[model samples]
Target: MTKALNEFLESNLKELKDNGLYNEINVVEGANGAEITIDGRKMINLSSNNYLGLATNETLKQAAKSAVDSHGVGAGAVRTINGTLDLHVELEETLAKFKGTEAAIAYQSGFNCNMAAISAVMNKHDAILSDELNHASIIDGCRLSKAKIIRVKHSDMDDLRQKAKEAVESGQYNKVMYITDGVFSMDGDVAKLPEIVEIAEEFGLITYVDDAHGSGVMGKGAGTVKHFGLQDKIDFQIGTLSKAIGVVGGYVAGSQQLIDWLKVASRPFLFSTSLAPGDTKAITEAVQMLMDSTELHDKLWENGDYLKEGLKSLGFDIGHSETPITPCIIGDEKTTQQFSKRLMEEGVYAKSIVFPTVPKGTGRVRNMPTAAHTKEMLDEALKVYEKVGKELGVLS
Candidate 1:
């Protein structure tokens, strides 16, 4: 039986390798920043989600070190036990204020926050209206909730209204909720919050926004709800400390009642260990920096615009992107993979996104421009892009 199982696994693995679909991991030698060293060679990195360049910021590093000196290391227990430290309380309060919500609760990871928050509130009798293009975390969370899922077309307010209306009219569900990503990660498009809010209100549906990518990038760094001036209307505002905030963990900001219920009901909050002192402190400092100045955020957008314009000028098909996450759309998966390999050989570290992660034909090389990138670095990257494009026949 063991021999048969091993044979089955080997066959599947061989199939993947043969199709060029098997992924090979690359190890980064140091901290993730605008540029990274891989295999002892430094390259201009365009694959990180560290939008505001806070991941390796000096102030955040100092804050983390201080916390480690004071608090030692890990939280000894779960939040429901004795693990809720002063740092955790402080971070939650800070996040509540930042999101303009009444209360907030932190979890082990952004992914866990979704898993905890979604299942804590909605259940099998409930129905979830999710965006087709939402992040994998949101999808997993919704699935965990045991709720009947209804996928609305991506950012289509009319389709959302019709589906939501139909779900409500059925009278079979105990509750209904609409969830979406504030900013879609792959395409960099903003959700139509105003229209979504209006539809939710009309259908009496609870609203949830996972602002993982938008939290430290939009609304002068306040987030997507604040960007649309709809803070008071969104039921749950989910965000991550791992991305722009430069630390690990996630949180859900909402009404005092909702948070109180989650504190008692969420399994992850009750079962999982709390965030470490270092992460809590670093995230707090990052938030303070966002509130203090727009320097980093402005630089991020400046780099984004600069790179986007350069790619367009080179006759490459840069897709429609509202934020800094740009995708160089090369329709064929094999060609896109080849293009990415060539870019790596030329000392640029952009990754190719292929089928399953995206549609099969619309494979792309996604570029995440950060605030730490210099204009000189971008110019060099653009030169390599032009050279690779012509060599690969992607450009005339």
Candidate 2:
């Protein structure tokens, strides 16, 4: 490597470490369920996004194995070539039905779905009004489109309306689009989709919602779009199969014309290899399970409520979460990281969120209670939380 490149990387990494912004990844010894083993120790894991706990579901694992036996492991090529298998088509069809859309197209990952779909439809002449708290993938996707991005105040409808009116009246662009997350992951607040949709309609703006964190956890496992009964109104519904679905890949569900356009014009779909046969089969089975019963969904909410109440009873600032996601707020970044560390030492694994990821001085240890967590496991985790919080002077 060049001397300048090496020095640049080393200096940035040192800065990240000095500022407590560096991430240290942990390894799970076995399946990632309600509890995970790390470094020969077992802990109740509260840091995962496996909402319905389908990541380690036996049924989904069997489906994947069966697909591997019959179809092999890899996709072999990009979708436009020979990678579009019958399973991929079936997965897309099932996803469309689940999301209540006319058609759907799949990508290698949720990040890719955004990058591909956004750049495919939007152009330099377009302006995109995006939520300030939208995911990083959405920001990158907008950048790739070369569109004029206007950051609207997060979840503030009045601000969105004003910005949309200004951008539309300016006549500085051929088209305008509004994009946001169906559920804000950090704060666990559900977006005001109805209001956003109304605003978009008034301004003749295209609508896009990334429901990555809401699928399989809202609307009886349908999604936030279906949660608000605006399935037909939103122009684009993007979701991931990796989180609640417990598999891998991402997709966009919309009208047939939009899906066809993405299929042909999306660079990721045209150039990147399609999802593996095993992942496609597993994701299809997972979605079918979600459609078949609400058992997992209900259990997940039950656990979430139980955990939230436990944290609040202990006098921890759990934050205002509309969904199952819980955050134990700690005022300072160092103290927040220390709290998480002590919790892990006491047999609970909750990660800390600090600057850049969240606003300064609002550092929190985010918890995700899943359907697979038993009452006993949650109780134990609560006990650990109480112990750690008290030790850290976060509780009385």
lDDT of 1 by residue, 1-396 (tens): 699999999999898667656666889999999999999989999999899888999999999999999987887899888999999999999999999999999888889989999999999999999999998999999999999999999999999999999999999999999999998888888999999999999999999999999998999898999999999999999999888887889999999999999999999999988999998999988988888898988999999999999999999888889998899998888788889989999999999887678877998999999999999999999999999999999999
Native-referenced Cα lDDT, model 1: 0.92
Q: Please identify model 1 stretches exceeding 4 Å from their true place.
A: none
**What are the Cα lDDT values of the candidates?**
0.92, 0.93
Q: Estimate, for each residue in 1-396, the C-alpha lDDT of model 2 and write its tens digit.
A: 999999999999998777776777889999888999999999999999999999999999999999999999998999998999999999999999999999999899999999999999999999999999999999999999999999999999999999999999999999999999998888899999999989999999999999999999889899999999999899999998899999889999999999999999999999999899999999999999999999999999999999999999989998889899999999788888889889889989999998888988999999999999999999999999888888888988
| Model 2 stretches astray by more than 4 angstroms | none
Clashes of each: 0, 0
TM-score of 2: 0.98
